[model samples]
Target chain A: MSSSELLQFLISGLQSGAIYALVGLGFTLVYASTGIINFAQGEFFMLGGVLAVAGVRIGLPLPLAIVAAVVISAGVGVAMERIALRPRRDSGALVLIIITIGVSMVLKSVARHAFGPNEMALPAFTPGPPVLLLGAAIDRQVLWIWGLTLVAVIGLTLLYTRTRLGRAMRATSLSHDAARLMGIDTAGVVMISFGLAAALGALGGAAVAPLTQTAFDAGARAGLKGFAAAILGGLGNPIAAVLGGLVLGVLESLSVAFISSTYKDAISLVLLLAVLFLRPQGLLGKSGREKV
Target chain B: MKTRRSVLATVLVALLMAAALSGCSGKGNGGSKAGEGGDAPYRIGAIVSLTGSYAGLGTPEQKAIEMEMKRINDAGGINGRQVEVIFEDDATDPAKAQAAVARLLEQENVIAVIGATGTSQTMALRDDIDRAGVPQVSMAGGSVITAEFDKNVFQTPWPNRIVVPFTLRALKDRGLVDVAVISDTGGYGKDGHDLILKGATVAGVKIVADETFNPGDTDMTAQLTKIKSASPDVVLLWNAGKEAAIVAKNIKQLGMAVPLVGSPGNGRREFIEGAGDAADGFRFAAGKILVPEAYGEGTPAFQVAKKFIADYSFAYGVAPDIFAGHAFDAFLVVTDALRRIEGEATPASLRDAIEATDGLVGVGGTFAYSAEDHNGLTEEELVFYRIEGSTWVLDK
Candidate 1:
């Protein structure tokens, strides 16, 4: 590839990587607090897109529609935690996984019924000509994706480090019983983490909706990729999840550019499996001592 | 009292035995003759994707089939036997499709089957239908299903192989020689891409680039960028549904002004709506068009399509898709064949009648099939159309 072409590829990769990172963060946040791999993370993403479209259909402005999507998705995440996850709190991990899978299916089916089986495209965020970068051109929506992803990352980092709720959430993640004994509302922490994760997923969906076009079924693939990225970066580690998302996105872009486009998804799966086989703790994940 | 109860039980047992025997013997011709002046209901099965990725394609086809059945039944039924269509949801999975066909064969006891929408799904059940000696008509445009003549299996729509050549001819006529072909890595896409390549070679068109993506991929920027770099005069998209739409939008987003061309998937309303103004100037072969002037004003096909569009819009509040038209056509053809069979409603007889269909008008153009050719329509039946103002307008 030419230098300009390479730059174009990198820009496109980073744009997609940002979306992946946000989704990965959602996965990491929920897993960290609940010790459950919320398989419905992708559904939250899809819900965001569908809800935004619904808002637009109701004559809401684009920005308002995005906010509505985020609010609705966050509410849904809290409801899911209360109804589905809380009921099965004492259940095994396998049961929790199945429940989330069921939730994903229910969410997908509801979306299908409401949105119809056809794919839907949101009105473009910008009406101007596409911005050319190096030798390649990309739409302004991609820029929005990059901007939103960075903002989400910084916002989440600040929340986790500088806020009282963030410290409580960290405490809950470390030891739920201990946090509860120390006067932290552990249930509230779980709900808050799920809501925040869902909001991030929703933002990711809204940011990419103009580019990818929203479909009821888009979540399954996105969810799988986000989960794979989370696992690759060390499940529960926010920083690692973001890094992994970028790496996977860039690898996929490179594969499509150089190898074969057909094997792009397969390459991610292979990479995830390879990482697990080689380093069970993930790239940046530290191996923890087993509980007595 | 014991004797009274035993006698009542014996009588009930006798009646139950008689019912069971009659039900078993109902499979025979003699048994059918005894049923209310030979007015037996003939069952036709449909294995359609009522849910899943292909639901948009399958749902309309199902509706069309039902509408055709209603039309046929209104016309004094098909050869005096009421047409009964049993619907099964395949969910667009091949394994489910196989089981669905078996269920239709064993449980529903349908004389013939009308659907199996995707190529993989249809191919999965082709052997079972062939062995069962039942006629199976597919709306899927895969050529491999009918490449070798199967008297039992028929396709109402022209296969992609035939349609692809016509598409190339139209593009070549328009002086689009340098082409980029993008397909999905599946049977449908591979078949379509292969045909496009063959047609391009025949038409002396240079393939500037060839690319493929898996199903469910939302991003095509990389592929589109590469294709743009090659600077092809036209881009040939050979994927179905969402993938095709994504490619179209991405190509436009990349600011590549090449005209996009392809077969029917790109011709659908979904693609036009998904790609919006970017889909303008996109051309593809429409398997059928509701041109009242060409098909004649009062023809059954045209009349039905007009009513279908109105009713579909009234019912679903959206225009009926082309798949609905194809499904409607397939249903009409099957009903016509059933009427031809008249008294002999066996699976074998129905297959023979369907194979002998000639000059049958359907929503998807005229179908004329023989034992040698399972695909009823030809390339001549396909009309080229371009998206104009979000509607498919005939390309002059």
Candidate 2:
């Protein structure tokens, strides 16, 4: 590929990589606090986009619509935790994971009925012609995705290090019994993690909706990809998950351009397997942190 | 011991009574109403993609079928037997479609099967349909459905065999001879992709670049970027799912100035709605229901399309797209055949009657099925449409 063509593919990869990173953050957040994978993370992304579209149709401004969507999706995440997971707090990890799968299915069905079976798009935050950057065309939405993902990452890092709740969440992830003995309300931390993860995912969805339209059934494929990204970056490490997502996106884009677009997923799957076989802890993950 | 034996016998008798009563209830209205002489309903099975990637297409198809069923039964039924449609949701999976067709044929005892909304799903029903010896009127537009030539199968829409060559010729006439084909790996897209390759040679066009993506993929920028480097005169998209909108948006986002042309699969309101302004100037070939004038003023075909559009819009609060028209035509073909049956309406007799159909006016143009040809519509029934301002305008 020519230099310009390589740059074009990289830009495209980074755009989708930003989205996968945000969804991976959701998976990392829930897994860190609860020790269970929230399979419904992709539904939060779908809800964010679909709700934003509904908000825009109801006459809200674009920014306001996105904010509303994020807030509502966060609320849904909290509700899911309280109604489904709270009662099953004593349940094993396997049971909780299955419950999350059930919740995702219910959410998908409800979204279908509420949004109807059609793809919906949100207007660009700043609609204009593509910005030509070094002989490569860049969508304005691409900039929005990168900016929002950075903001989410910085904000989450601050929350983890600076806030008391963040410290409590860390302590809980370290050892649930010890954290409880230390008088930390670990359950509340878990709930907040769900909300925060959902907000981050929704923000990504809202930003990307202008580029890729949202639909009722958009969650499953996105969820699977995000899950793969989370696994690629270590399951519990949030920062590594983001890096993993970016790596995955670039890999998929380059494969499509250089090799074959038809085998992009297969190529990604082979790489994922290689990562798992070589280092099961993920790229940035510490070994022996998770038990099989 | 004798007392315990008597109690067990009583319990068994109660269980048998419950089973007998439940069996009677399971028969529904069909058993009670089958008194004699055409009081029974003509059961037809409809397998639709009510929940998956093709849900947008199948929802409209289900609505059109239900609407037509109401109209036909309200007019004192089809030859004194009310048309009852048993609907099954395939969820856009071929396996589900196969299972649903098996149940429809063996259990529901439907005289006809109307759909398996998408091309792959429809093709999946062939084994069951052939085994059951029933007439299956498909709503999908893949040419393989008819070109493969199953005697028991009939299609309502213009197949890709007719549309692909016409589309290629149209591109050639516009002085756009170089083509870049981006098709999905699904049934309809794969089918159209093969035919496009064959027709490009016959239509005197050069195939410059070819790329494909799987269904449900969210990004096509990489494919479009490759196409950009090749700089084809036109980008031909062959996909029936909602993902077609993404290609249009991707082309616009990448600032690629190539005109995007699509197959009949792109002829839907969702395509315009999903792509927004990016959908402007997008072109596809489809039937005349969008612009009834394409049927010609005061023609019988025009009158039928006009009524269907108005009725469908009133019922659903929006205009019917080509999928709806295809479903309407499928229902019309089956009911029209049912009306023409002289004696007992077995699947064999109904299949023969449908094959003998000639010159019946309905939504995707007039129908004329034969023993040799299952898809009756020709190139004349199709017109080129350009999407302008999120609505399709007849391309002059």
Candidate 3:
């Protein structure tokens, strides 16, 4: 392949990687704060796309539709935490996982029934010719995806590092009982974390809807990949999850371009398993120390 | 207090007994109603993907069958007994399809079965369907369904052999020779791909590039890029659903801008929406078109399709896809046959009538069947159309 062609392929890979990173970050955030893996994270993504399309179909402007999608998905996240997760707060991990899976199935079924079993697309937001950089054509959608993902990541970093709420969240993640003693409402933090994660996932979904049309069952694969990225990145580390997602996306793209397109997804899964087997702490994860 | 409790318990027991007896009587009446005309209505069962990815294809099929059933009943109740159809959801899974077929055969006692929308699911349940001496008419385009040609099994859609040759000829007529084929790793895709390859060879077209993708794949940039590098005259896609559209979009994104051809599955609206302007130049074979203009003026088939589309859209609030046409044709064929064998509506009699169907016209072009050829349509029934501004326009 020509260098220009390679550049085009890489650009596409990076754009896709950005979306996966945002979703992976959401997975990491939820897992970091609570030990549960929220499988319904992908459903939140689907909600974003379906809601935006419905809003646009009903005469809302594109920007307003996107905002509505994000808000609605975040609200769903909070409701899921309250109605599904909280009800089984003291239940075993297996039960919690099943409940989340059930919630995902319910959301998927509702979307299928309401939207009908057809793929839908949101109207494009940007009105212009695509920009070309080094022979790689970049559309306005790709620009939005990369920009929003970076902004969300930086904003999340600030929220988690420099704020009082961030410290409280960290404390609660470290020890809920101790954080409660320190006057933190641990339950509120959990709700906030789920909402924020869902918002990020929603943003990713809305941004990629133009590229990958929204279908009722679109979330399952994307959610599973995002979960894989999180686990590969040591389950709860934000920076590691982002890195892992980017790496996985690029690897998948390159595999399709060079190795074998049919086995692209398999490459991600294989890498994830290898990482867990060899370096479970991940590249950027801190090793846990034994308590004396 | 003890005396009052005993009296209340006795009254509750008596009411329960009465309710149970009434429920039994209602069921008994329903059974008798089913057998009111001396013999039970000829029960035909359908296992369609009423839910999940295939629902878009299956739901309309169910509607068409119901509409045909009503029409048959209105026309003297099909030789003194109404045509009854029991439908179940397969969920597009093989195991579910097996269970569904078993339930329809054993519990519903349906004489003949119609549909199991997907190829793999249909194939998985074919042996059992044949074993039960129940005839099946699969709507999917898997040629293997008829390879062994059980007298009990039939196909409604154009087999891959017929569609592939028709597609090749269409491309060849357009002066396209070298082609790239992108197939999904599924029975339908593999079967279609092999047939296309054979047809291309017969047409003396070079196979420049051949690639495969899995179902549920979103990106096709790499495959498209590689195919573009090979610089084929046409890109032929033999997959269904989102992948076909994604490939179209990615082909545009990479600036390949070549003429694209697809299997019948690409005729759905989703392909146009997903590919947007990129799908404009795309061509594919379809059993029927929604627009009357595509069929030109004053053809009998065109008139019927126009009326069906108008009535279907009025009821469903959306234009019907080609599957809807095939389904309408399938329903009409079965109902017409049922009318023929109305007096003796046994499984064997119904199968004989269906197999003997000839010169029948419905939504899908003219369907002619015989004992040897269970599939009612031929390559001549398939029409080629190009995507033009979100609708399929006939390719003259």
Query: Per-candidate interface C-alpha RMSD?
Result: 16.0, 13.0, 14.8
For model 1, how does the per-residue alpha-carbon lDDT over B310-355 read when each residue is reduced to its tens digit? 8667766777777877687778778888778756678988888888
Best by DockQ: 2
lDDT of 2 by residue, A1-292 (tens): 6888889899888877888998999988887787777878988999999999999999999999999999999999999999998998887666677677778878888898899888887888999988888888888888888888888778777888899987888888777889999999998999999999889888888887888889987777777778788889877667877888999999999999989998998998899889978986679887753421
For candidate 3 chain A, the 10 contiguous residues with the lowest summed lDDT are A283-292
DockQ-wise, the better of 1 and 2 is 2
Instruction: Please tell me which model should have the higher TM-score, number 1 or number 2.
Output: 2
Q: Tell me how large the interface RMSD of candidate 3 is.
A: 14.8
How are the candidates ranked when ordered by TM-score, highest leading? 2, 3, 1
TM-score for the second chain in candidate 1? 0.86
Best by lDDT, which number?
A: 2
lDDT of 2 at B186: 94
Q: What lDDT, from 0 to 1, does candidate 2 have? A: 0.86
Clashes of 2: 0
**lDDT agreement with native, every candidate:** 0.77, 0.86, 0.76
Which residue runs does candidate 2 get wrong by more than 4 Å? A288-292, B1-37
Q: For each candidate, report its DockQ versus the true two-chain complex.
A: 0.22, 0.30, 0.23
Flag clash pairs in model 3.
none
Candidate 1: docking tier:
incorrect
In the range B136-247, model 2's lDDT, one tens digit per residue, is: 9999989999999999999998999999998999889888899999999999999999999998989999999999999988888888999999989999999988789889
